[model samples]
Target: MKKQFNRMRQLASQTVGRAEKTEVLSDDLLQIERRMELVRLVSHNTHKRLVSCLQGQVGTDSEKRHKKLPLLALCQTMQDGGAQLGDESLIGKMMEVCGQAETTLASELMEHELQIERDILEPLYQLAEVDIPNILKQRKQLSKLVLDYDSARTRWYQATKSSNQAMAAKVDSLKDEMEEALNKVEICKDQLSADMYNFSSKDSDYASYYLTLLESQADYHRKSLAALETAIPNIQLQQGQMGGPTTPPPPITPLNSPARELTSTPPPQRNGSVYLTAGTPHSQGGSRGPSPHLMRRGRSSLHVPLKGDPRGRPRIRWEDDISKLALGRLGIPQDEVSSLLELFPSRPDS
Candidate 1:
């Protein structure tokens, strides 16, 4: 008897519990429209702010020589270049955000559909298959019982007044069963109303939170852009100084001989001097000209660098033919070094 009573209560509940109306889903997509609008608005605001932040800026012509440029203008050019780099880089980041926004909305919409499938549509399918048909069968059984009860009661009263009282007693029992079923249906309907309202309210709250998420993303990008604007100048300064030291031409290295031998030969000098124009090995046809070592040298004076040589000093050999001379230390030639020393008396270092 208890099992029968519980089944009866269950049937009454299922019959009265109408499909859960997802009024949040049913509302004419106003919330979706609002969210999409926010996306557009945020994108426009981001682009506008980025443009305004890096607007009216000049860039340099790379083909032009930076050395010919003034220091102030060079610094300015580097600064502008850094700002341009930051702007372009951040614009790319903004584009990434745009792509994410578009795809995220698409996924959110798919999720909402899945939510509907999981929460409302599947359970309603169960009602259609089992509960609804069961309720229909119970309603038909009650209708047939009503007719039978009426016929039985009428027959007992008129034609068979002496008939058994069980016939009338069964009709009263069926009436009580129908009354209980009606009360259960009323309670089930009330519960379904309360439950669906709460579900719709919660769904709307989730949608509101989705809007908050978009606002947060936009805020993050804006802060990053501000940081970039401040940091690019120092990067410009570093890049501007990336070029290393400038190198000058190498100095001339003097050679003393006709042969390709190392020598230290000094350049020729002319001055007011009265020297012997007589027959001397240094004189030529009564008029003396400076030696090849003095005029210039047998080879170039410029120090040619070899691979393994550490010191780049000039390898000049100034005492070329002087080694062949048989002069002693005490018997020096007056027409040579001692003579030149006497000629230029003031320059001892030279």
Candidate 2:
């Protein structure tokens, strides 16, 4: 028993000592791992700082690529440590590009939704439904009203020989029809008011949607343009960009067509009156008139005033379309046109 007891005690001591030693070894191992991690982190930070400095110093594309290549390679080596070391710089750059693209796309989405509601759907809804059928029904009632009135009159005439009971019933029915027609008219008027309200509401909504769409488009364009301004270099304004003819073209005159004369035909006169002018009397006691050659239509044997017939002379004129046509061809301005009109001074006869 004593020997067994000693062996048990010794076994307990040996196990306890090994447990303490294991705990110590584990702690030492953890410390060595921590030192390794620190060394790795410091070396990587030093490399990063050196590359950043070199990139700052370098200007050539090849040198930049050389610096970038190692950075990309180092990311792969970051392994599980990436979560601890990687920052949000690249992520923020990516977000910046996405924001630019989304500005235009979001604008388009808003425009599309507005178009669907305002242009495509609302207009169709307005045109498709109506209270026209109710108006038609009212018209039908009005047509039947006339018949009811006539029938009631006939019934009353027939009832004069008998009792007036049936006649009174039909008369009452006719009155009911009249009241119904009035009621229908009132209903239609109320419906028209409602329709107007709906129409105005729809119109206002449609216009508002267009305004929103335009505003959104403007915002999108502003953002996109800002990005483009940053991305693209400014172009220098070149000289002589404004180009056109330095001098105006000369004005063109229009040609006139030949006029047809009716010299052989005598001038027909009605409402017996003569146009007179200052002239001498004829030797045969007949009246002499102003020279026909100076008057228009001389080719046609026309009436001549007795020379000094003593009434105010009527002014003669001719076609003046040629002058107007020339002015039109010249493309004259309003002020110049007024000046030309004054120069030409168109009369009622011409």
Candidate 3:
């Protein structure tokens, strides 16, 4: 009985020792699980703190990458330092470091983008509002100036037209007056020719007297021819000296001075009028008489009088008539006659 009791006691003691060993193993496992849980909690808290710091210090890119990380994986990484680490505390420190680095890089990139926008966009907007509007207003003002210039040019053209028309009207009026005066000159020339023809029909007793008158008339014509010849060189010399037209020579007087024997006879009466002799007595007792034959032939021969010589019969004033005709026909002002004559070629006397 003693031996059986000793065996059972030994078995019971062995069983009790095994159970206590199992309980101690179970307690160590629970303590280990609690330690792991604490490590995980501590790692998760550290990662969250790191992430929050990155969000505040850095910017969006880190937050976006962090959102992709699984909560369990992130926790495991935090507790173990990395996938290679079995230590929880080390893993937690590594995860916090990675989150902080990502935040810093994102913050630098955002700042760079902000600086680029400031450099490029701000000046462009200002140019659009201020410079572009000023350019448009300048173009509009130039258009208005062009329009005003065209209007002023049109007015200048109108004024020039009106002035030209007035000048033309005055010229036409001057032309009409000239034409009327020319007609009167022609009538005077015709009457002088008729009177000369009537005087040529007188008797032969007047032939000797008419012959002397012819000689005197021929002498006067010769003098006129000589004077005309002398005038040509004088005019050229004067024009060369003055570089312009010269003033016209004064008109010569045409009063006749007969010889002493021709002036002594009395005057005759014919056709109910007293006919003065070719040479007749002057009031100073100077003899002046023109013979009967002289009177008839002289009337026939004398075609025109000299200029400014009204003392002679009006029939002989052909040069005076020509000046009047030139004034009437050519529309030259009387004051400008000397200048107009300069344009004519010098003529030879017949």
Candidate 4:
């Protein structure tokens, strides 16, 4: 189509010579094409919000009908539902080792979001969708070849001011169409000023690849805090072997506190009439036998308060053949026959 109507009439004569200021360009190549169109609109919205934050998905047809899991695949589906609801308990093995340390920290955060989408969003989407839009489309074809070399040097100075000898062969064909439109605007202004000085010298190597993507996101959060500090000592040793009532109890014993005194004997108070004394080694002629403080308070069974017994209530009698007697027939004193057979306490027959 006649070269798209002569490139839309050379973009409407360079938009009427840039609205009459007569078409411009070099304000340092228009401030490096407005700082490369603000670095291509901030690297095309930072490579579409970092590929929708590493595919945790905002696919966008109004959130693509909403089904997007990814908190590390919901932490590996809560570590396979806490290892199938924790079989060997201790709080289900501390929720199956804290969901297997958050599913190995979500597989090291999905290999650190696939190494930041392969080294920082594919080189910032190849410099915002292909090298600064191919250097702003070769600076709009060198602004329509500087408006076709100023409309062929104004028709070769109006055909050399018409002194007319048949206008000197139309002024030598308008001086070879104004020297072929000034050699195509000096070869597209020397290849768009060498691609805007090679994109300002690679902008410091793209800011050191964005500081190596923040040092690989601080080494993926220090390897997810060293895998939750190695699963917190196996969840505190399974909460101390699943212990219970967790502690604080045993002190009460009060309610008017008196009773607990009896270690046994209290019987042979002769003048008070309570006798049954048998542990006799020999307390001299007084015949007082069971006394070295009741033979060092060892024996126990001694409820002896029987006198005329009209049920005055003190007849406890469990001597049960005192283990078939024979410590030399109970003349006891073999160092009190093991405290009289430990105060004789058996009672089978009535």
lDDT of 1 by residue, 1-350 (tens): 65355445444544576212112222333343344345445544543453343212213222232322343243445445545556345443333333333333333333333343344334434433443344444434443333333333333344334355675566565555556554554454444334334433554543443365455446545655554555455444433454423345565444534443534343343221222112235434464544444323212221232324455343233232221231332233425533433322121231
Best by TM-score: 4
* TM-score for each of the candidates: 0.24, 0.23, 0.20, 0.38
Model 3 regions lying over 4 Å from their true place:
1-95, 159-350
lDDT by residue (210-318, candidate 4, tens digit) is: 7988899999999999889888877786677776234467665554334434434343322211223445555464555455455334333333223454544533232
lDDT of 2 by residue, 1-350 (tens): 64345334444544566311111123443443344344335434543443343322232343344334433333333432434333344333333444444444444434333444444334333333222233334434433433333333333444555556776566656556546644654555455445434443454553453366466557646765765565333211111122323346765533321222334444443211122243356889776655444233321223322234455244231123322433355433344433333322222331
| Model 4: number of backbone collisions | 0
lDDT (10s digit) by residue, model 3, range 19-47: 11111123443443344344335434543
Candidate 4: lDDT of 269? Answer: 21
Backbone clashes, candidate 1: 9
After aligning candidate 4 to the native by TM-score, how far in Å is the CA of 82 from where it should be?
A: 3.8
Error of 1 at 323 (Å): 89
lDDT of each: 0.39, 0.40, 0.40, 0.64
Candidate 2: lDDT over CA atoms?
0.40
Runs in model 1 lying further than 4 Å from the true structure: 1-167, 199-207, 244-350
